[model samples]
Target: MTVLDDSTAPGLVGPPHSHGPRRDPAPLLPDPEPVRILGTPAAKTFDAELQRDLYRRLVLGRRFNQQATTLTRQGRLAVYPASTGQEACQITAAMVLREVDWLFPSYRDTLAVVARGVRPLDALTLMRGHAHSGYDPYEHRIAPLSTPLATQAPHAVGLAHAARLRAATDPAAAEDLVALALVGDGGTSEGDFHEALNFAGVLGAPVVFLVQNNGYAISVPLASQSAAPSLAHKAVGYGIAGRLVDGNDALAMHSVLSAAVEHARSGRGPVLVEAVTYRLDAHTNADDATRYRSAAEVDAWRARDPLTLLEGHLRAAGLLDDAGVAAAAKAAEVLAGEIRAQFDNPPDPDPDSLFTHVYARPTSQLREQAAELAARLDADADAALAAATDAEDEAR
Candidate 1:
């Protein structure tokens, strides 16, 4: 049944010695440094670049979220969600992915979107209830942000499946692309999450489910989300590997996400990562955290704050020197100025666009209404102009 080809396979294109005295693939990866609780051994990756990046990224994300929240409150935005303390989960995980990988983010994943190069202004379109969002996600390797809880997980699975198909067909597109879908802790309670997990596992889809464990689903805490001790353990039901990382630690997050991406590329199936972090802000512009939670609890979580922990490690390692920290702070100040400038003078609506875009040919009812409105407006304008002219003639 072999249709033999004289030509060798593309990857096998090497001189006869390319295989060079076969060696067992060195252990897939060196054993990773163990997780640290608070400050045990510091997780080994707390070096200069990692520390600086972690600190600046958290600061940048926080400032951006705060500015966006202010924009919403000032009636400039329709709505907004702050990633807030979950910056570690978003920014560092974005660093773990190659530009070719796809990200399916939720409404709250604006920082992750920014990390992947989506502009902050574009994110506001969706929240502002625009007819169409301004962001072209495919151009940025991001899918549209899903507001429907856990639904995007399956879309991530579908994207991975599509990548697998292309890899099998086109040599040019063969590098396996891992698709990541970020979801909230409450989202995992949906049936869609289970279905996506089982399907991705069965198909060996290169996908990662990043659960941002911000401790609550609005007012409900993780205690009520699921009975599993940790959400990552849910991977067991699908016979996939999973890990729980201190989501507040960017270095630890990157270490785990890099491993998960490698595992998925090797066709090991999807990996579930439960990132343990907290949401310092309300679920959105509408929700009130104080209504459901006590001040002590918020202050307590803030004490183990992600930014403070990263700053401590940075100063300890001499990566974030006082000068560098000052530079980052000033840069953030500039960024705030830019966001304010944009919010002050935003895009104007094309009023008649309501009937122009939805269908190439207008429906009968829409056409009739549009014509009536246009004529009525024209008649009113004519009457106003005539009245003005009459007043001028009398004055003359």
Candidate 2:
């Protein structure tokens, strides 16, 4: 039987239902204001121990940014995107996840990688132009710092879905491992970002997307990127919960991100959290932020620096003293020294090592190329040794 429209059957015609019923969009919308825990009543109830820990991490994260930027100027790092003002987001993103969980970070998120237990020097390997990923992803459960925008989102989704499938089949050793994918505000424009969120929403996979909306996507401001009210609102279209939080407030970031991570781990659909923050530094050491942004604007953000904000809160509460500050500084200095030492005397990367572990069975072309390179290197070494021997004979 064929259903007829009003032309064929008057009873078939529906009233005011051209596109069927519209879903309630209000439920999907983010809070009217970004969530704030600092300088609010909520701060009073926040755990003091957690606040102190966050303070230490924030201090260290800032130092990491500074050191990395300096390394770029000193010709150690190839490039550095200093997340100076966005330390709160980086710190909270790392601290919220468990060891069993995975973190997919962007190129600028070296601090997050370090916070997740990757050595500071190893985390900088990609930026140092030394390796694809300095440390193995499996070793730390963190993906390589993604240089391509939004690519890691899908990777996180796939990993989260895979983990859920394993947990479904194996109950004894099963654990709730959440995949936290971090992307910048600019990354949301990429197709991969939408695809990842769509997959997570459909599968109810254990994944959380923390988008740090650091004002500008390099030189292009967010206003020029999209007309969406906020980046968080984009999640509503994918049938997932959206959140907005003050990214600069460590406590707020921790609270919001922790909830999202827990929600994902509990097998709830994925959540999109847009942290409202600003990039204090240029896109990278090479890019001049002054061209796109104003000094006054940068000054305004610097006033609300993550470290300063947290430090003030801690001091007011008597949780941090002068001694505590000194201790944190000492720890940061030690880390800076380690990073400098590693860079100053970095181990020479074997060219042959690049050909190794690329595949289970090497391709014919790869084998040929590796052999060619090895032969060339051997010939060069032999030539150098012969020259040294001739020099010794001349000396005698």
Candidate 3:
């Protein structure tokens, strides 16, 4: 015993070194080929009503993107990130959620926000340079359109985890509350994305992450983003399930997102979905897409447009005819007209609004700054009035 070698030592070679238990990676892995339902035989079995509704929404979403981009050009919006080619992912993400559920959208997801019952104009408030978010987040259970990359991911996880904890004590209060966060493929490279996944997996939070992999993140293409087989594959590392769907196929997006929402609502933890899509337009009105990608590439994605795909499927299934197509287009035009009418009469800027929501309780420095600004505005107004009075008297 005193002459025991390293191999025979109790501490050095203890029981072949077992590390608890190993988890099966197969269940977490995503399908090699993205799931397709629009052109597949599965389309025939999908609900007729749901297919019609999805088609309608996809058409409306596309028109919304076009109108919003036009607004940016006309100076109505400070900036607009059009979800043109990715309308299927945008609309389906909103449609799958319940009223009790929450949606966290990226800056480019205005279509999703509006589809979730938020007013179309309200969805563009931030892009219009408004100081506050356009709509009441509580009313819609939708978070403000997040401008920072991957920041919304953690917020979605935290809210879902808190809801799960609360549901543990008050069973009915849970209502199977789930949170769905939308992120661009570029966001996947962020540290916040990684941390959120880790936390979500460890806590078994009821959250779903939908990554709209629209080829390029701004000017950087997906090839430069990550070398992972697919963005969904990243979920396996966090012990969560992963899914890949044809982002341009409305039916596929609807099916995948619905399943993901149900999976999370059942307290099965988080799911990461990668929707292979393309951003037909530039990243934003400010970016020149031609600088990075070719014209042929954009045209190729345009051929697989979400609206076109859904519309084709619906027509083939006899769910949509000439009249139905006309009706959907008419509704979309009405929405576009409403948005334009609202922008025609711009809201007057309120100087006080600058400090309104900055803090719950203003700090001393903030109060001082506010006072200084107010005094300056008052003085300027008084000077203008005096000058006007003098001009009037001289004319008399």
Candidate 4:
């Protein structure tokens, strides 16, 4: 009997049909070594003023993380996923976007949200157990802090695609608008991640997915989480560009993310950037990091802290002096103080807000539920009033 070879089969041969334009994967592949700027010759060429600003933000971000962790301990916050060692990725992600652009951040990205002009208190509202997102997403062009893994990826793509479509008819609508979604390494395993990238590549949506691969997905090491060469390599599978950078290198992260944002804005389709940083704190206040990671591992990463790395570069370059360091520290302290004061007496959210934005036109069932809630609230108020009146009558 003769066996048929699969390579000679009718449908197994060459690229005979065209589905769409074929892209060169070589251009999309990330560099073998993660990009670095701090402590390198490239650091000399970066803008001094911008570097100074970035350093200030890093300082503020560090303080913000510390205060948030403390708040969790004090029971002021329900939970906080501190970005202690990933300040560079967090702050750079926010700074790269234009005011018109949108940001979709994960639950661990309160630093990015705060860096994007959101009040610290508002950024922590969800962690404070608020019913509604503390800040108005429409006003800030930012989605709520997504607690669900990879869910914001699709939302970012949708917004970017819609903006691109609008720009086709009215150029003014675009205004170089793009969407940047920040996700953790763990989120990459989700189906939504694959779907978002697939749609983004096919539709040529103007969006950037920044994966902060901080070594672990809450305790599961990257080795166990993914077998990909690197998280950035995953982008090439979707026919989009990929980039890798030292997540702890503030200058490099800013540079890489800035270029990625512009690339998306110019309609080059989506880009995926994997920032190789480390998470210094536990997943949250409740998580015992010691249970999973060794102390030496944490110490190793602490030495390469984003703040210390950037500060050393700045000081060595004569861009930052003792006075500058002191000033940055002072500013950071002020921010920490503000966070403490606000969280010490956080205002209670309106209970009715739960039903406010649930739907554009409330369904009958929703209306019925809202009415029932209101009735209960009214009854409680009436009972309190009657009890107070009775107490006063007894005193008389």
Compose the digit string of candidate 4's lDDT tens values, residues 30-91. Answer: 99989999878999899999999999999999999999999888888899999999999999
In what order do the candidates fall by lDDT, top score first? 4, 2, 3, 1
Best lDDT among the predictions, by candidate number: 4
RMSD, candidate 3, Å: 3.7
Residue pair clashes in candidate 4:
none
In model 2, which runs have C-alpha deviations exceeding 4 angstroms?
1-23, 388-396
Residue-level error in angstroms, candidate 1, position 76: 1.1
- Which parts of model 4 have CA positions greater than 4 angstroms off? 1-22, 385-396
lDDT of 3 by residue, 83-107 (tens): 9999999999999999999999989
Across residues 1-396, which tens digit of lDDT does each residue of candidate 1 receive?
Answer: 223332645444435656535423222222233244336575454465666777898888778888888989888888888888888888876788898899998888877887888777776678767645658978888888888898999999998999889888997878668999898899999999999999987788999999998999999988877898678878877767767888887778877888888888778778888888899999898999998888999999897678788778777766667898788888888878888886677777665777876788999999887888888878999999999999999999
Q: What is the C-alpha RMSD of each candidate to the true structure, in Å?
A: 10.8, 3.6, 3.7, 3.0
Cα-based TM-score, every candidate: 0.83, 0.93, 0.93, 0.92
Judging by TM-score, tell me the better candidate of 1 and 4: 4
Name model 3 segments beyond 4 Å from true.
Answer: 1-18, 390-396
Per-model clash counts, in order, read 0, 0, 0, 0
Candidate 1 deviant stretches above 4 angstroms:
1-34, 42-45, 352-396
Q: For model 2, state the Cα shift of residue 207 in Å.
A: 0.9
Estimate, for each residue in 190-228, the C-alpha lDDT of model 2 and write its tens digit. 999999999998888889999999999999999998899
